[model samples]
Target: MQQTIAAPQRDLRPLLALVATAAIGVFAWLAVSTEFGHSLAAYDPAVTTWTVRMRHGLVTAVAWPLTHLGGTLGLTLLTLAVCALLLLRGRREHALVLAGAMIGSSSLTVLLKLVFARSRPAASLLLGEPASSWAFPSGHAFNTGVFAGVLAGFVLFSTTAPARKVLAAAAACAAIVLVGLSRIYLAYHWLTDVLAGWSIALAWLCVVGVIVLTVRRRPRMLPAGGGPRAPAAGSGRPRDQA
Candidate 1:
């Protein structure tokens, strides 16, 4: 006789917990590393040179609009709007995951900037002046990475259609890269700052992805004979299983 196969039940709570823990650990490590600080300082010159090159005439004009369009306010608002739509569509779990990714990355950016207290470039900025805070990690870059990476992860793992998923992934990557480039082009941050931002954001996102995958791979409850077990008393059917 043939045996019946059932889908696996994922426990996302563990993955979320793991991502949160790893995020905190990485942040703490970065905070305490004097060597990382020096390393970040060394990467500044290359970033500055690239920024100058990209800000010349036409490039500056084009990048100005693109960069401004992808600003923190714009990205945040866009993310929130999309998240609302996702939640309405019964994707609350994904929305929450994305939101966590955004909040975690942004919080770390602010905290690290405060701790480092590194100064922004003294030379004239290509696009605008810096006033908000010190430079060590680029908030723009970090936010871009977190937002884009998380969005990409959701699309890649959750979407059924291959074409749409690929397109979404491409778009997410483009957005992240452009935002990082914009920071350098606008001279708002050192190359080192942007690099550090990218690294931390990517690392955090990787941790998130790993957790999500771990949860997705968990075994579902099944009958001893190997089929989906009936729900006990009040446990309704697994709601979309994320």
Candidate 2:
């Protein structure tokens, strides 16, 4: 009888890279097309309707606070604080991957905004003055999408339990959708802008996810007998596993 050892699965990094590249191509095409312009023009009526609807009711009041809460720098700092905790808890690889995803996605959004030079919605429904920026891709939508998607990916990939994975995925979906809605309600971005932002952000997130999976699939060698142990609790050697 022959003995067999199961081979580890191949990494999904290449697949993610391919998806990310494809998404970029699609976003580039949309940015350059007259259709995107036409779409923006066509959406004005709908935007007005939605904006008015959002300005009233208890739901609007509730969503208002939560949406702006996510938009604040303090919330961003809190997220970073959590990432720091993950690193301290020996999840440095996950932390680095998430950090890269957030930073890289943000850079791409900025570059696209400058390159497209798209304008924001004419109407300002929100309490304060509107932001000044090229607005084809809504930054709030993009950032929220990337943050939620990457966090979900990390949770799904790292956790062994199925229920937790489902919860994380649900949370991600809710966050992305809510953020996109908030942008439209506030009249900060056109509908097409939010859609484009979401499409591109999701595509980039999938790419990053593939990369993470690919990295995780590779075999790592440990020293004989698990090598020297950490001298203190939570003081294990930090390796670039991801």
Candidate 3:
């Protein structure tokens, strides 16, 4: 029964990979357009103004810490802690994957920033100064998107209970959305920047995930062209395996 359920999923991985590749290409073109003065994302300033206007003391209080939580230092600590927990729980593969994903996210952010060299908003409403980073894609939003998606994928794959899966998915989504909102509300990023961050993260995660799962499921072959090993004589009949 499990094989019946899983086979179709395996078959769909190539399709997923293709979709992810196409998304990455589209986003790359969008980024290039923004960088070369083609300026496809003209609404960025208006969205920034709107968010600034809607800000309040109470909301700022909430958004202030939320933004930090999605920042590099904060997310770094969280990722290390989660990696430790995963190791202690004997989930080495999961820990490695999570750490790799975060490292990739951070590296990608830096590379994109350098390539685009896009400037941040003129000012940050919260700090009264612009953040000292290139801002076409919000690093906070990008990092949080990857973090949320990886954790949610782990939970979904590890659990069989419907309610648990739903809860895990919801929590991950909430975290991603709140972090993105905090960036916009604090005037740290334009709406288009945050959207681009999320779009790229989603595309990257989907491609990496499909590749990892497919590779992990490949059947191991015996050396020297040997066939499947026979069951031990006293164990059981070979036909009983099925």
Model 3, C-alpha of 8: deviation from truth (Å): 9.2
With candidate 2 superimposed using the best TM-score fit, by how many Å does residue 38's alpha carbon deviate from the native?
Answer: 2.1
Candidate 3: residue pairs that collide: none
Candidates in descending TM-score order: 3, 2, 1
TM per prediction: 0.70, 0.76, 0.84
TM-score of 1: 0.70
Model 2 residue 41 distance off true place after TM-score fit, in angstroms = 5.4
In order, the Cα lDDT scores of the candidates are: 0.72, 0.73, 0.81
Taking the tens digit of each residue's C-alpha lDDT, what string does model 3 give over 1-242?
11211233446577768877876876786687666645657777787788888878898899988998999999999999999999999999999989998999999999988887787777635445667789878899889999989999998877579888899899998999999998888877777678778888888788668867886767554455354566778886756545
Candidate 1 structure quality by residue, lDDT tens digits, 1-242:
44544466555556655665765565455444433655445656676876676556877777777666566687788789979999999988888888888878778878988988877776565467655787777788778888888877777776379998999889987887878787777777777666667767877887777666665565556556566555786777665564
- Let me know the TM-score candidate 2 reaches against the reference structure: 0.76
Candidate scoring better on TM-score of 1 and 3: 3
Q: lDDT score, residue 30, model 1?
A: 46
The prediction achieving the highest lDDT against the true structure is 3
Residue-wise C-alpha lDDT for candidate 2, range 1-242, written one tens digit per residue? 32333356665667778877887776666665524555444765577567766586665666666566556363477569868998899989878887788778778878988877877766545544677777778777887788888778877777469999999999988888887877777677777777788879978898777766766655666645565544565778565466
Query: Of the pair 1 and 3, which is ahead by lDDT?
Result: 3
Extract clashing residue pairs from model 1. none
Determine the backbone clash count of candidate 1: 0
- Residue 95 displacement in candidate 2 (angstroms): 1.1
